[model samples]
Target: MPAAINPPVVLVLGASGLLGRAVHHTLLESLPHGVVVVGTGHSRARGLIPCDVTDETTLREFLAAQAPRVVVNCVAERRPDVVEKEDAKARVLNVRLVEILAEESARLGFYLLHISTDYVFDGTKPPYKPGDDPHPLNAYGEQKLASEKVLRGEDSGERVRPGQGSREEKQGGWDKVWTEVLYGPSADLAESSVTLLARDVLAPLRSSQKKVDDWAARYATHTEDVARVVTAMVDRALTGAGELRGTFHYSSKERSQDLSREEGGEQRPGQGGGRAYTKYSISVLIGEVLGRATKHLEPEASPPEGAPRPQDCELDISALQEALGEEATRSRALRDGLREVLQALAANRMPPPPSSAARLRLLLAGLSARQKSLALPGAFNGLVARAVAHAGFEATYVSGAGVAAGMGLPDVGLAGLEDMTRVIRDVSACSGLPLLADADTGGEGGEGGVRRVVMEYQRAGAAALHVEDQVFPKRCGHLEGKELVPADEFALKVQAAARARDEGQVAGEEGGGNGGLMICARTDARSVVGVEEVIERAKRYVDAGADMIFPEGLCSGDEFLRVSQALKGYNGVNGGEGPYLLANMTEFGKTPLLSVRRMGALGYHATIFPMTLFRWAMRGVLEALEELREGGRVSKTALREGRLLTRQETYELLGYTPGRVWEYPNANAYSRRKGTRRSDFVQEGKEVMEEEDENEASGYGEENPKKK
Candidate 1:
């Protein structure tokens, strides 16, 4: 029998960092529905928390109110020189904030699981195990190791010296003795993750006008892998509480750097003293957080796919495995770690793009100038959409057979409505132009088939859908082995599709509460029978109120020319007929890539490029993977040299920094001003009496108290 799946609420601190973000993604995917995973971080966390992490009073209140089963802290300074300089900054985070988290989380018997790194162990030992003693050479390593000691305490369940400050301060860091009541005051230290990151990373990148692309290419960590693991383990670890005390060293990959203090002089940490040092340290942390960490995840997997073996900082999981099982143990390997890092980074990478609402819409006009002209058959993707809106083509074609071939699936109408919707959604998101999606012989199911097809395509964000008069499992257009639906049934389906399209409105959250789908009734009747029969079918469809008429397979451009001439002369079908015409242009297929000017001349209203993005994405991944395989390790160095944008260059472009990254001569020092606000989360740890009434207030709305 399997272990019964029981997961509780897990609170993740710094839920926006490479590691913390990864954990958030992982947990969301692994846990069953209703398993709570509340995330917290400063407003700078992108959007996770509305306040700062250093505000102890609010941080405590927030935790106490949530009353989660477990608290996992993935927060850290991550910068060496900054911590090395003012040391207090590092202590405040690496050591102090953790103490605060543990004490606050303890309110509801929350057991804590925090991530510490191998930097704690100086490279003196090869593959340091859980028991290996640490002797850190850098400021980052030293502070983390020190913080671990502070978290563990003098002995489990006993009073220990404070993580920060002299004996006089009395309260700060995770140093609170577990048994003591936490409602106390002390002189507080103040520093926010935002400030640290700004001077170090954002400031510099902004200087370069926010050109981080170069910076990101170098130094990649698999944040995705971390997200998967934490997302999976948080609840399990939180299940059992009481007497749980210790630091969990997460970095388990092969070692880097030497134990000797003077090794790897890449950059002098405290170059111009403490102030300069702080800047340098913060800069590195910023790169780690912003650039690669924010990649889009899409959706995460369980023990997510493509895990790499032998990754960063090897973690000792013998105890965890013993306590849990082999599955958990196996997941602790390097590959698992890499997968987590990758997934997290990918998830985080998704840019907060613009969506919804209408605007003037930006367009590229030139040879792509919006000029009206002619269109050929076969418009299925990106090129088509571009042609429709900006290329000035009268109509673009979408072929049913082409759609199937693009997916690498059989064209025998095997592609379902859902599949079509997905592809169309992506195309629509990419293409702002009008679209004419293929509905291949109406649809798969039955009566009112055209209604079903039209409804779905409209919801899929399509401007139009084409329904052909063909039988079930209709063969590809322009291909043999095709059959036809009863002419009458086909006629009804076309009417339904047309009615669906003509309605023209968006649906409510509930299905079918808006303007109906736009329908383009297609006639396969032309090629099968004579021109007269096809013409008759077209007339009937028009009578049924089709938004447009698609007559498949005309022989040549002259035939098209003849039809357009005839339509102008005809009297029936919605007055003289010049319906929308589509031309599908696919790679290695029928039509070739045509310039917008040429497409306009051809009378094509639009074109589509469905496979362009997928092809590019796949190629990039494979090349990167191959490079990793051949080179032993993925290098952080950019393909081209020259400062690799150095955190500052990337920041400079944004024009959203404090003066400039290099202006202070040191990125880390608190040179700008005094009176800077402490992270809202840490305000609880401050002396209450000293605070003004306004200072004591918490959260976004001071007037509205948070509900417990």
Candidate 2:
């Protein structure tokens, strides 16, 4: 029987790296509902915490907070030249980090899968089997070799110093330790699984039916299947019901076929008869997968000059099969995995520069150049952001008012910098849209404070922020009795924010680029100092490096038109015709709620419906509670039509498959058995004649193994 395992919360370190990205994609594709995949790195593309794995304290704090059941460490400083030059940094990253991870893994009872490289072995021998003695010839290889020791008890001398404590007194000195080793190109460490290799890596090709004549050294694995094995191991570990507490090596299962068979050969791909599985020469496998003729695929007899790389470092996975069961040997065919890579290459033949900053820059350019483009930001949190993204909004917004209301507080300066930033992060994770956040007087601190607030919001993945000219205890823009700070003082705060944004850009901080830190300077001065002063403040704010001009609390259409016309000819960040305008259409606001069409006619670029959704949700909640008070029971009619999102729609919004994947085998193809050509659900006692006939034709079946 399958174990009753809840989907585990998994964390992938170095998610921006090649191997890490593949693992991240596999987890998202294969894991069932309730599985949380937190991928973190020091890159904006990672879309999570800007984490540095070398900082033990920061890593510890993150681990404690997340408390993940599985931590996949895909981080390594593997560049030999860099490591040799800075051995201290390399040791801190590659060696010391593993020690800390093992300690934490034991204490936290989480499974750790640290990715080590094939560089741990020198190229003196061909087909260096698993468990062979490592003879590293470089600084990079030394660090990886040392990390393997740290996982086992071999490198525990520093922890168990003389007279410091008894062996058993140490925190992670328990005998029940689980360790696993994988050599060359396990799905856990293969770069090719996620990226398309350049043509040079697969050139000088020939097409032939026969296998290659020469022998060369290379290793590869299908990571998609490997990910499944790892997930299973993690699940069992979480239940504490597995005897898999020891080292094991994982590598691809090799198979060879008579390629001389014609295109219409009796045997199809992945079909085997009496032929035993045998390792294919690296040249033959590469030629077959890449569609290159065997004659053109040459194998190098020796390593290239100055390139210290292992040759024929093939891992023996017999132990891995025993530990992970028969499924470990059922890896996908090399041709199939290569087809995926080829497809990606064909689709992205001339791939554009990919980064969050680049995307945001394009989004900004589009929004600015398009005459009177409108966006509606109503996301209260990440979940709502998903729904909002599906609703087809060009951009998202984090409303300070909505954040305060979500926390069951009034928008009277209650949402601090961190609180709003947390909301921004959550919202950013669920949507790819560039977000504009509301910053209330840059979070209430004085003197060089708005700059820090700007930096924090930028780090949280906000594309733009609007800092209003409000006093310390700022109220909602639509609310009565709102007060404003002096125009010059507010301008200084705007300048500080601009400087902070510029500095971040220079340092290559997250969100720091062409569309980086967009400052939308807002003025509530119309109520405090009348129209002329409001116009003057808007001009000064733009002069202080504001990207967009937000004139809050406009009383009429004529007033909004005046503000828009006054800001014309002002060069915003994206070099648009005029400063982008933001119009807030809050319910019960002083300004009438205008349609996006009318707002555009008045020259407003973006319109925000900040508190509309929250108010609507609360009204429904109150009415439902009142109904429960009167009826004291549940009824079908109680939930009005379209009152809430349907389960199917919610599932679609959350990126979930339509059916229960665990119960429905065909719901997710990734969960199916390896080498199974067809994914289908069979009714009980119902014979699938088509599949049976295909299996019989291929000379393979459950009851009979066909002979050649």
Scored by lDDT, the top model is 2
Candidate 1, 1-708: lDDT as tens digits? 232233355667887664565566566456654355655554323224333566677677767645555676777776555666767756777877766765554434565666776565544344345667766666677666666665666424553433233332322223111000000011111132222222223121122232211110111224443444444355444343213234333322221111212344453221212121112222343334333222211212122112111112333545544543555423232223323322222222232211111000101011112333333234345433333333332223344555665677777888777777765554453333324577777775554565677766666655456777877767655565556566676767766665555554334311221223445666766557755666677666655656455555555555544444444323433222234444334454333455544544554434444344445545776777887898876566534544234565444322227532211111111111221222222232222222223422222121111111
TM-scores for all candidates?
0.35, 0.47
- List ranges where model 2 is wrong by over 4 Å: 1-361, 367-370, 505-508, 511-513, 571-576, 638-642, 658-708
Model 1 TM-score is 0.35
Show the lowest summed lDDT stretch of 10 residues, model 1. 177-186
Q: Residue 153 in candidate 2 has what lDDT?
A: 57
lDDT of 2 by residue, 194-256 (tens): 222222223333363323223323445655555666666555655555525444556554434
Native-vs-model 1 lDDT?
A: 0.44
Clash pairs for candidate 2: 187-223, 206-292, 206-293, 207-293, 208-293
